[model samples]
Target chain A: MKSSEWPLVIFSLAIQLSAGIMVIYDLFILFPMYRSRVAFPSKYHWILLIALGAALVGVIFSFLHLGNPTNAPRSLSNIGTSWLSREITGVLIYSALLMGTTILHFVMPSAGRSLKWLVDLTALTGVILIFIMSKIYMIPARPAWNSVFTPLGFYMAAIVMGASLLLLFQINHGSWASQKSLAILTISIPVIQLAILPIYMSWLGHPDFAGGKGLAILLHNHLIAFYLRLVLYLLAIAFGFWAFFTIRSDTTQNRLLFAPALLAWASILAAQIVDRLLFYTQNISPEGF
Target chain B: MSTFGFFCDTSACSGCKTCQVSCKDKNDLDAGIRFRRVYEVVGANWNKTDEGAWEHDIVAYNLSIGCNHCENPACVKACPTKAMHAELDGMILIDPNKCIGCRYCEWACPYGAPQYNKLKGIMQKCDFCRDYVLEGKPPACVSSCPMRVLEFGPISQLIEKHGDNRSVYPLPDPSITRPALFIRKHPGAKLAKKLNASIINREEVKE
Candidate 1:
């Protein structure tokens, strides 16, 4: 199916950003401090609870796009023919698994070596969940969303945005290592994005992409918008590459990398919003009936 | 058994969107929500080519789409919730209450007919307006198309009316989703065949 409208994309992005922020807050902010042998109020329990709760809220927020919210359960019925159903099922399963792992982490944090192994396993599962989320949009039937790079592109975009926001939080919290961490992720993400952007755009500009009605709409009666989108994506790629190439070896002690990487990260975020907006706005839904 | 089908004549279609409006009206659908939509496709972006010569050969193509009621509906097989079902009469219907807003059908459907109502927490799509059809009436979209681009009847009848010419592209030749629709062969098809023969001849000469 075609992507949702701009308003819906903006709303979903807002929720996703919020949920992502909270997730980062709990993982990067709270967890590190808890592990640092510093005195913290209450236990990590409260943070875990909050993170899970916020994720649940995010899940609920996702429901806002449904036409028949009441029939949420039946979405699973069409798995044989639908990717969305698989995504929903995957999300539910992943959420449940995450919740379970969160509880286990809280209730029995003393699993020692086994705990490390479990955490690694759970992280892999989270990665898989993210991949599945990307797959939800990668249907070949919709040429715009069908390319091999789509899932990877979306994942990189999410990670770029997510990691950028996380670094932003860390920087705000006065973490000296934020720059180092930010530099590393920023460099990698853009490199990945640069490699993927061409493929993604090629798919978008494919000789056969007659279905990107949203792009066609945005490009309607004018070529400027198309060029503008092109420039935005190119700029995003350039900034990412610049940040990657200009990586300072002294990042563990320097501030310059932080500024540029932060800017690059912000640019990437902006690029994503534009990309997502175009994605939603450019679709020509099969004349809906 | 009933095999529902649609007949669209691009030459006659004025791109009025009557099919879209009628589908929405009959389904009692919400605004900003479409069960059928009409698209206008303009021809080649010649300037993008290196030749710097742009040829604007825009053709007006109007498509009124809904559930194709396919023989091998990808939406049905992929649905984890079992929300969509094809009846004996070859109509695919979604039970809104049963849909969990998963949006699987949306992805599975090449036609992009299954819609997710975020507020309702379920999926909804055109049931061929089967509610009226059962009562011996045509679907709102079929009856509403002023240009008569959207016609519904038995699959066999549609095949006879317009055989194997429903889309500019071959309509996913593998038929993975088994979408049931037809394309009208335009003059472009004839031109393409001519071009293809010349290209093959050129390749043979080069070889």
Candidate 2:
């Protein structure tokens, strides 16, 4: 991949991770609290705030991907036809909602119950943001990225990162059942990614212009990186399962649960980073080669 | 609308690269940016004769290319800021003021027409030498071709005069963007593809 595209790698991953974090928070924490009055731990506002921080980081890096950051605001002008425009709009709306939600949690803690709808809206926007982001790479000329794998990889990477990160965060904060569930989610997403790998490779292995070239790139040129990505995913899956079994059915604030969860997060982060790098490499233009 | 287009007689192109140099000079492109590129398609294979002797059949040709200013340009549709748009004559161009320099159009164009200018921090491409076209002159590459291989005109006229062959070996399918390039294929292009010919000068033209 070109060095110039590195900013895009970080931008896509960070946004997906941020969206994943908000979605997980909405599903595991906010929904339960809204429905059953499971009052959040005192430091729970930090979660949404962290999500917003990640979103901000993503948005900032997105500008770094541009040739003229000053003109980025005009990038939204063509949402009528351009997926890039739609993606920019989605990022702006998602980031704004995330900021507003985080502000509400920080400024009006007592009013948290009344603002469930706002949090839900922010989470929904985040999901749509990831979808729009994936659509940016679904370019018809870029046959390597013009497939279901683009959206699937984005979603799975986001979910795994979110689940792993939440497992680390809630080690001593949340209930055992929820932490265990997060661990299971962490395990499943990567495992599902592993399952999708061969099918994606097989599709790429077909004897055609883009397919043969993409498979050759992965297997011949970037073989070490491809293997490293796979190994990281497998390592993440193993660490997730370890974290899952480590958590007991008690509220003893287990200190031992931290290592595997942290490892899982770290491994999955590396995997996703490598995955993004590899994704850009797959931009095998039909004419350039 | 009068759509600008390119007519490349690949049969006459001798890999001289004068057209490519002319475009680079006219646009003042840097080392990594090529508004017009020449691809050398080369391949050969050996065959066994009835006399039990091996004979090789070789094919080689050049494709000197620039922006086609397509009727359905992927770059135009892909540009988020509307910087890459078509004029009334369908000559696609980039407006620097509105360009975010995201380079999405560069990726969307199958012909690799849109090139990133590191100095300008924006996407740049062949404008069909719109200024020259307006002044009743041909594009730089077209005028500069020593062999008279490159030509440009209204796309329909080019197609009708050139028999509508828009792509040859290794070029993308023209149907993808309905590119305005009409080509007179080199006689060896079919043999080149059968032998799995590829662009041999990729390093020289990389963007």
Candidate 3:
């Protein structure tokens, strides 16, 4: 991949990671179990901070991708037809709602009913943000990314990375109530991602899908990166399962869980970075073929 | 709105690439960037005749291409900024001031028209030589061809003159973008069924 595209890879992953964490946090942590068990308001602050920090970093990286960052505001002018414009709009809406919800949670700690609505709105916007993000890559001219697998791969990355980060935070805070579920989720998401690999590869190799040039690049030049991406995902799954079983078997809530959790997150994030690089580099314009 | 368009006669072109060179010179394009390109398509294989003599069923022709300034330009639809916009004369031009250089239009265009100029940090393409056309002068490519294979005029007039035969090997179906450009295919041009003809100058044209 060209060095110029690194910022895009980082930007997309960071934002998706932030969105995924927000969705998982709202569904698993905030709404169902935590409201009843504990009244710890500080945890909400930390979760919001992590999500916002990642999102801000993503925004910064995106600016680096632009030739004239100051002119980026003009990108929203074509939202009627351009998916890129819609993606920018989606991210802005999601970020604004997320900020508002975070402020509401802090200002009115006892306003449970009101806060639930805001949180749900933020989570929904995040889901839509990811959808728009995937749509931006579904260009008909570039056959490598013009498939259902592009969106599926993007969502899977978001879920796996988000859940892994949340698990790390949970371990750090000594909250083990939902460790088993989170662990199972983290492990299973990558497996689901792995299940789609063969299908994606088959599609890439198919004559009707990418034409000969795209197939040649995938099978010849980028074959190693593709296989390495699969290996990293498998490693991440193994680490996730091992961390889960290890934490489950140990009744003491040992301090050693941190290492495995961090490892699992790193492997998953690395795999996603590699996947994005492949997506950008192996793009074969149908006209060129 | 009335639109200017190109008419190329592949039957007369000799693949000299003067059109491509003159376009680069006129635009002052940097190395590795060609606003216009001449593609050499070649298809041949040995065949045994009924008289038991080996014969070659060979086909060869040239296609000089730039932006077609399509009626339904995907680049315009895909551009996030209004940087890529159609003018009053139906010519698409990129405003560098508004452009963020996202390169999304590069991926959206099937003709590979929107080229990223890394030095300029913006997308660039043939604007159908808007200034020249406004002055009632032909585009650089149209004027530079020694064989007089290239012509430019109002799309309606060009259609009347050229009869709308745009399909050629390696070009996507014209219905996709409804490109304004028209072509007069060479007798030796490969048919749709024989589109497996290799592009002879792949390295030169690949951006």
The TM-score of candidate 3's chain A against the true chain A comes to: 0.91
- TM-score for all predictions? 0.65, 0.96, 0.93
In the range B114-169, model 2's lDDT, one tens digit per residue, is 88887788999888888898999999999999999998888778867888888988
Give chain A TM for each model in order. Answer: 0.63, 0.96, 0.91
Instruction: Give the higher-lDDT candidate: 2 or 3.
Output: 2
Candidate 3 lDDT by residue in tens digits, A168-246: 7777453466666677788998898888777777777776653556667766887898889889989989899877976
| Segments of candidate 1 deviating more than 4 angstroms | A1-57, A73-81, A103-107, A158-182, A211-275, A282-289, B9-66, B77-80, B100-108, B112-125, B129-152, B157-176, B182-207
- Candidate 1 local lDDT, B1-207, one digit each (tens): 238776666556776777877777777777656776664432332234467766543333444466677777767766667767777776777765466665657766766667766566677777777777789888888888876777788778888878855454323542555566665644443433223211112121111
Query: Which candidate gets the maximum DockQ versus the true structure?
Result: 2
Tens digits of lDDT, candidate 1, A1-289: 1354543455435434433443444455445655774433234444345445645665776676655566666555545555566666666765675577567767677644444444445445555655665666666455566556656655566556656655543432335554345545655666666566556655555544554443446556335644655565556556655554544455444344456556766676676766666665433332211
Worst 10 residues of 2 chain B by lDDT: B1-10
Ranking the candidates on TM-score from highest down gives 2, 3, 1
How big is the positional error of residue B66 in model 2, measured in Å on the Cα after superposition?
A: 0.3
Instruction: Give the candidates in order of lDDT, highest first.
Output: 2, 3, 1
